[model samples]
Target: MRETIQKVGGRLAGMVIPNIGAFIAWGLITALVIPPGWLAELGIIGAETADTLTGNLVGPMLKYLLPVLIAYTGGKMVHGHRGGVLGAIAVFGVIGGAAFELSSGAAGDPPQFLGAMVIGPLAGWVMKQIDDFLEPRTPAGFEMLYNNFSQGFAGLGLTFVGYWVIGPVMSAVATAFGNMVEGITDAGLLPLADIPIEVGKVLFLNNAINHGVLTPLGTAEVAEAGKSIYFMLESNPGPGLGLLLAYWFAGSGLAKLSAPGAAIVHFFGGIHEVYFPYVLMNPVMIVAMWAGGISADIVFVATDAGLVGPPAPGSIFAYLPLLPSGGGAAGVLIGIAVGAAASFFVGSILLRMFPVKDMKDTDADADIGDALEHIPGISTV
Candidate 1:
């Protein structure tokens, strides 16, 4: 069990750039940190139906559309054009479809059972087979297949199946998921007073990188980068209370680091770096990061911290540019100070207990490609 956990942890860490990003994004949306605002109100449509309906739409856009794109692009890069195309198709089918089903609930745009789940896998398999057949025939390389009419037909045919036939089904499923959250809200299972702080935490629309201060200068102006669906989630949290709870229990080690400086980063700052490297190295550290994330998510949900605005990465320094800046700014500063300190202490203790050995160049072949083997799925073969 320990070995299995270690392996899974390592894999999770390894998949960070592509798959993990999507998973984290998915978690954010699930936590309702990036929920569509109207959803909450729609429940009250009889009470505030218009608002809830609006929120439901936002949920699918963030949860389904964004993550599916990330996952598809990532998978495509890993596999190739074929891999990329199928990856998009599959992610759209499963994750997106699920989101729609969950959000809408009732008979909606696309019927669920008949489409995304079935068509998605079928498209993915066909794409994979096509890729396999086109594998580099020459001892040295794979020639360009862009001009191949037969391959093009095969690829597009699969796409036609997915987009026209399967698209709406997936959308409905995602909307249905949104509907469930609404149901909970309507039942008074979620309180209104807690909304501000709870929703404020997840900002379900924001992305992790944006929360980390990596936004390029003028990028927001030029491309509206800061306003991106992912970026918005980074700035605004979904009610991540449930997720935070899961991580707290399952990832205690990682969670303990939410100390003064570190805590601030993951919590208010939403940087998440505190446990990143640690988790990557030890793998078990993920147990903690995941726990912290899940717990924070749950709290976010409960607090109704969901707010909109460019939640500048939480820090007294970064808080300068935000609106109604003073109180939030102060809160940001205090949280960072406390969180970082707490994290330092926890990290220190863990280091003492389980010393991580420094990484070494042990590959027989020093070429970077050789390093790829250590990671899973460098090549599907």
Candidate 2:
């Protein structure tokens, strides 16, 4: 079961890692150009410039480009370039279906990322199966005709399925998940959310959860509240920082030696993925993450802390500009501090009790990247 989960996670990570650059570009553009963003707030760009860039670049990239990229990657994973092309073609139907649903008065405009992930691989597999059956039956002079027509027809059917079925289903699923989170917040049990979130982050569902689920809900909340705690839930760097700090101080050999660099990336650079391998290496350390996340969320609820926008990359630097002014800023800082301290204390104890065992026959001086390659289902990206 663990191996299976890791394989699934590795695939998911595979699709997203290649696209991290695009996500970062979109995030940076949004953070710098949106109203209350860094450039506008700093008086470096006027409101008009910010608005134009946002309207022309940010919204389309989020709505169209990102999901298509994900679908293309996923399809490529299943059946090479042909599968990728089909996947990209099919995802348009999903996007259109979602837009149609929204036009009927849906409360939120959730990005079709989840829909893309589902349809991309499905489209690839369908094309692969079609080729497997059709190739053997095609006549000697009809190879090109068989190949082109098979994929074209399959893509057309898949697109219709995506529009009529997959899109509506995925949108409903997104809505349901959002409503569930909203219910938790309404009941004053937002911290309880960390149970699934911390566990999911380690399993490499962090991006799917954050971008597919949380961001849409958080965006809706921001429309009413000017900020939303939903953005902080998965992206908070405190727990990962504390975990890496514990590893730095208490772990052994390669894991210990690599901790400081990973901590810097996870906390300051806002690449939270750098710390996931540590948790993967030491599954028990997830408890420390849970403790940290829940503890921080408690503070967030008490202080009503939130950011003006989602902090992409989730680094301390990404967080700085998004921080609300005055007490909210202090609250965000305090919560992060508390989370880190709590995670560090608990993680330290766990490492002392269950230190990461060095791999048998591995060199003591092996490079961290080389050592990571030996771990099953770990992605160093």
TM-score leader: 2
TM per model? 0.39, 0.72
| Model 2 misplaced regions, further than 4 Å | 99-106, 195-231, 240-289, 302-315, 322-325, 341-381
- Cα lDDT, model 1, residue 215: 31
Give the lowest summed-lDDT range of ten residues in model 1.
362-371
- For residue 369, model 2's alpha carbon misses the true position, in angstroms, by 12
Error of 1 at 236 (Å): 10
| lDDT by residue (tens digit), candidate 2, 1-381 | 644443443455455545655765776777677666678888999999989988898889877898899899878878989898999999999988863222213354556766787898898899889888888889999998988888889889999999999988866665555445445655668898887777656544465557655677789998998888989998999988998999988887666766786687578767675677677656778899999999999998899999988886687877888897645887788999999998999999999987665523233212233444444444444
